[model samples]
Target: MKYQARLSLDVLFKFIFKITGLLVLLLLGGILTMLVYNSFSFFLDVKPLDFITGLAWNPTGSSPTFGMLPLILSTTLVTIGAMLLAIPIGIGTATFISEYASPGVKNILKPAIEILAAIPSVVIGFLGIVVLSPGLANLSNLPNGLNALNGAILLAVMALPTIITVAEDAIHAVPKSYKEASYAVGGTKWQTVYKVSIPAAAPGIIAAVMLGVGRAIGETMTVLMATGNASMMPTGFFDSVKTMTATIAIEMGEVPYQTTHYYALYAIATVLFFMTLLANLLGEFFINRFRKYHAA
Candidate 1:
């Protein structure tokens, strides 16, 4: 009876796992169907080449054109800026925590990062507007307080905890023996970390970066509140900017019921959804490759 019960449980577990996977795939499929259904008019009427290559964004005007270039450029620029600002600091913080920090230090630092993650984006936005924007204006030559640099700075702060935590977890997962072996071969502590731990933990670092990217890409409240909310493409770090997520968030409520502009909004959303999907896929692929390289 015990043997049969164990076998039945195992069978049930396998069945549930398969069903769960199918459900996830179906959920994704359903979302795609909805987006496409709503977006059919836009895709059919809007010239793909024009939509992609053109730069105007008069979404609510009389002769509204839906060229996505400005929004796409702004979104990409902010995401890149945030990543550039966050990744190095995050990686360094992770390395220090995993390899050098004492127990007390680690305990303090870890909680600090966790708390950062828990803070609402709106609060961050408010801080940016009230505190950071003034500071940035005093620091820079921009006329208004809001700009890409300010948004990127706040986003980097927002991204820090996830990057640091995930990266630390990755580094910790590297076998201690790898470090020991490096030391046995006359390697210094820093050398061992740079050579063995970082290489071995490369996948996790990439995963962390990708996770941070996703957060930055999907972020709305902070970007909307902090980015000066200009719709034109950005000219420099100090320029007011708009992003795809912000555009959708701001316009979703006010758009015509079923106009081409309406479909265009859905289409832009679809682009973001796919971009995020691609980022995850690429991140997973690189992570697996890193795993195979170091694990084997």
Candidate 2:
């Protein structure tokens, strides 16, 4: 009787899990459908090539252009800069916490890093505006520090907690046997970490970095507040630039529904969605490769 009851419960839980998974897929499909449906009209009016390759985004001009190249470039610059700053520092910190820290130090450092993630984006933006911006402006001899560099710095800070936490978990999850084997072979701690532990954790680290990229790319409030909102083609990190999320936030409310401008915003959103999706897919590819290598 007990065995029958257990089997029934298992079936019920399996049915519930399947239903939940289907619901998630449905939700994602619904979002993609909505974006495509709204943006379809805009693409009809503007050649897809022109919209993507054009440099101007003057929606209120006499002729009104809807080029997205600047926005795409700006987002790419900020995301890349942020990753360059965060990845090395985040991974190093994770390595220390996982491999070198004493129990007490680990307890203190982990919670402090995690707490950083809980801080609101608006608060971080405020700090960028008041603190980091002025410092950079002075350092770079710019009038103000609100530029791609400032946004990248802010995004790096925002992404750090995620990268560190996930990477630390990944590093910690390396089997004790692996480390012991390295030590038994007369490898130093650093050598084992560099050779065995990091290699073993490569898949997780890649996923963590990709997750950080997603966070940096999709962030709205901090970039909006700090990135000066300039729509011009950025020449360097010192140049003020606007991101797609910032553009959408700035214009979506005022844009008339069903207009070309409205549709263009949806198109930008679709492009942004695909960029993030591509990042995740690449992460998955690397993860599979690492898993296969390790398995062999």
Candidate 3:
């Protein structure tokens, strides 16, 4: 009787999990469908080629321009800048916490890093406005600090917690025997960490980077507030520019429903979604390749 009851509970749990997974997939499918439907409506009015290749984005002026090239360029620049700033710092912080920190220091530092993730994006944006922006402006003698660089720096801070946490977990997941064997072969701590542990954990680290990229790319409020909201082509790091997410967020409320501008926002969202999707796919590809190589 006891064994039968246990088996029944196991089946019940499996059914619940299966249902939950299906619900998640359904939710994702619904969002994608909605985005596609609305974006298709926009593309019917605006040529897809014009939307992609246009150089201006003034949708409300007497001569409204709908070029998205500037927005795409800004978003790409910000993501690249954030990754350049965040990746090394995140990976290094993870390495230190995982391999070097004493238990007491580890407990304190890990919590501190994770706490950054809990801070609201608005608060971070405010700090960028009040603190980082002016300071950077003063240092560089730029007209204002609110530019791609400002947004990128804040995004890097936002992305760091995710990167650090996942990377540390990956480092921790490295088998104890591997480390022991490296030591047995008279390998130094640094040598073993670089050659054995890091290589073994490459897949997880790559996943962490991809996750950070998603975080940076999808961020709306921080970029909206920090990036000065200029819709133009950037000439340098200090030049102000608007991102697709920022544009959608800043203009969505004011644009009349069912208007071409309204539909364009949805199209921007579709593009943003696919950009993140492509990043995830590339990450998966790299992860699989690394796994197969390591296995062999």
Candidate 4:
């Protein structure tokens, strides 16, 4: 009787899990459908090539161009810059916490680092505006610090906690037997970490970095508040630029219903969604390669 009851419960739970998964897929499909439906009007008026390749984004002028190259470039620049800045620091911190720290120190440090993720994005943006911006402006001799660099710095800060926490968990999950084998071979702790532990954890670390990239790319408030919101082609990190997310947030409310400009915003979102999806796919590809190589 007890065995039959257990089997029934298992079937029920499986059904619930399948329904939950289906719901998530439906939600994602609904969003994509909405974006495509709304943006259809914009594409009818503008050539897809012209919209993607054009440099201008003037939607209010008499001519009213809808080029998206500038926004795409800005988002790419900020995300790349943030990843470059965050990757080393986050991985190194994770290594330290996982491999070197005493239990007491790890306990305190892990919680402190996790607390950083709890801080509101708006507050981080405010700090960028008041603190980091001025300092960067002074250092670079720029008129103001609100630029791609400032946004990258803030995004890096926001991405750090995620990268560090996930990477630390991956590093920690390395089997004790692996380290023991390294010790038996007279390998130093540092040697084992770089040679064995890091290699073993590569898949997880890659996933963590990709998550950080997603966080950096999808962030709206921080970039909007600190990126100077210039819709020009950026020549360097010092130049002020506007990202796709910022563009959508700023214009979506003010745009007229069903107008070309409004539809263009949806188009931008569609592009952004594909970009994020591509990043995740690439991350998965790399992770699979690493896993296969290690297994071999």
Candidate 5:
């Protein structure tokens, strides 16, 4: 009787999990469908070039411009900036927690780092506006303190915990046997870490950083709050900028649904969706390749 009941519970759990997976897929499809439906009218009027190449974004002006170069440039610049900031710090922090931290220290610090992950995006944005934006704008070279640089820095901070936590987990996942074998061969601790452990963990570290890229690309509130929303292509790091996500958040409220500007936002959204999708795809690809290589 006990065995039969256990089997029934197992079957029930499997059925529930299958249903849950379907629901998640259905939700995603609904979103894609809605975006496509909303974007049809706008696509009919503007050539892809208008959004891709045209300059200026004053959609309400008599000579309205929907060119998205400025927004795209901002997103690219900010993401790159954040990546530059995140990579070294995140990897270093991960290495410390996983490789060097004492148990007691890690117990405290891990939770603290994870806390950054839980903080609301709005709160982060508020910090950028109240603190970072003003401070950055005060730089002698920066035309506006609130520029791409500050927004990127904030985004990097937001992305760090994700990168650190995941990479730390990856480093932790390394087998003790591997370290033992390295020492058996007279490998120094740093040599074991840099060569055997890190190479083994490289795929996972890459996966973690890729996730950060997606997060950076999709971030809206922080970018909106910190980046001075100028719609022009950038000349340097300190230039005022606008990102696709920032543009959507700032303008979606006032723009009518059927106008060219409305569609422009959707188009920008589509571009963002593709950017995130590409990041995920690349991550998956590398992860699979690494898995196969590791297996071999």
Candidate 6:
């Protein structure tokens, strides 16, 4: 009787887990469907090509325009800048933590890095306003400190913890036997790390970087606060620009509900959702490819 009861409970748990997974998928599908429906509604009134290629984004004036090119360019520039700034610093810190740090140093530093990830994005945005923006203004002689450069710097700082943590784990996961063999062949510590461990962990490192890119690009408040929120073509690193996220965040509340402007925000959200999804899919592809290669 007890054995039968235990078997019944096991089946019940399995059924619950299955339902949980299905529910998550259903929720995601529901969200995607809603976004598509609303965005399609907006497209009925506005041509898709015009929306895609438009350089202006005045949605409230007498002659309101909805060109998203500037917003897209701004978002792209900041993401690229953040990734460029963060990748080296993140990977280097990860490598040091995994390979070079003494046990005592590692113990102290790992938690410190993790704590950085816990810091609020709003706080980071405020810091950008207080500390980073003023410095950039001084360095560049720009009238205002807030610009793409400021936003990129803030996003890079926010992304660093995730990249460092994930890359460190990947580096640490490199098979001890690989390192042993490299050293057995008389390779120096640096050579073994650079040539063997890092090579072996390349897929994971790439995935980590992609994930960091997703985080940097999707960030809203920090970019909104620091990037001057200009709806213009970005001319340089110092140029003020507005990202899709910031546009949505800033306008979603003030716009009349169910208006064309409201639907446009959903369209922007749809783009963001797909961008993050693509990044995650790319990361998964690398991870799976690495697994297959390792198994082979």
Report every candidate's CA lDDT. Answer: 0.91, 0.96, 0.95, 0.96, 0.87, 0.92
Q: RMSD in angstroms, all models? A: 1.4, 0.7, 0.9, 0.7, 1.6, 1.6
Error of 5 at 4 (Å): 2.2
The candidate 4 region of ten consecutive residues with least summed lDDT is 33-42
lDDT (10s digit) by residue, model 3, range 1-296? 99999999999999999999999999999999999999999999999899988999999999877899999999999999999999999999999999999999999999999788999999999999999999889977987899989999999999999999999999999999999999999999999999999999999999999999999999999999999999999876788879999999999999999989999999999989899999999999999999999999
| Residue runs of model 5 more than 4 Å from their true location after superposition | none
Stretches of candidate 2 above 4 Å error? none
Q: Each candidate: how many clashes?
A: 0, 0, 0, 0, 2, 0
Please identify which of the two predictions, 1 or 5, would achieve the higher TM-score against the true structure: 1
Q: Candidate 1: global Cα-lDDT?
A: 0.91
Per-residue error (Å), model 4, residue 96: 0.7
- Model 2 scores a C-alpha lDDT of 0.96
Candidate 3 Cα misplacement greater than 4 A, ranges: none
Clashes of 2: 0
User: In candidate 1, what are the lDDT values of residues 1-296, reduced to their tens digit?
Assistant: 99999999999999999999999999999999998787777989898778877798887777887889989888888888999999999999999999999999999999989999999999999999999998888778666679888889889989999999999999999988899999999999999999999998999999999999999999999999988888887887788898999989999899878888888999898889999999999999999998788668
- Which tens-of-lDDT digit does each residue in 177-208 have in candidate 2? 99999999999999999999999999999999
Model 5, range 1-296, lDDT digits (tens) per residue?
Answer: 99999999999999999999999999988877777666666778878777778777788888887887878888999999999999899998999999989999999999999899999988998898888776777774554578888888999999999999999999999999999999999999899999888888989999999989999999988888888888888877788899999889889999987788888788888778877888899999988898888899
Better of 2 and 5 by lDDT: 2
Residue pairs in steric clash, candidate 4?
none
TM-score of 1: 0.96
Q: Local error of candidate 6 at 295, Å? A: 4.7
RMSD of 2: 0.7
* Per-residue alpha-carbon lDDT of candidate 4 for residues 166-258, written as tens digits (9 for 90 to 100): 999999999999999999999999999999999999999999999999999999999999999999998889999999999999999999998
Q: Tell me how candidate 5 scores on lDDT.
A: 0.87
Ten-residue region with minimum lDDT total, candidate 3? 233-242
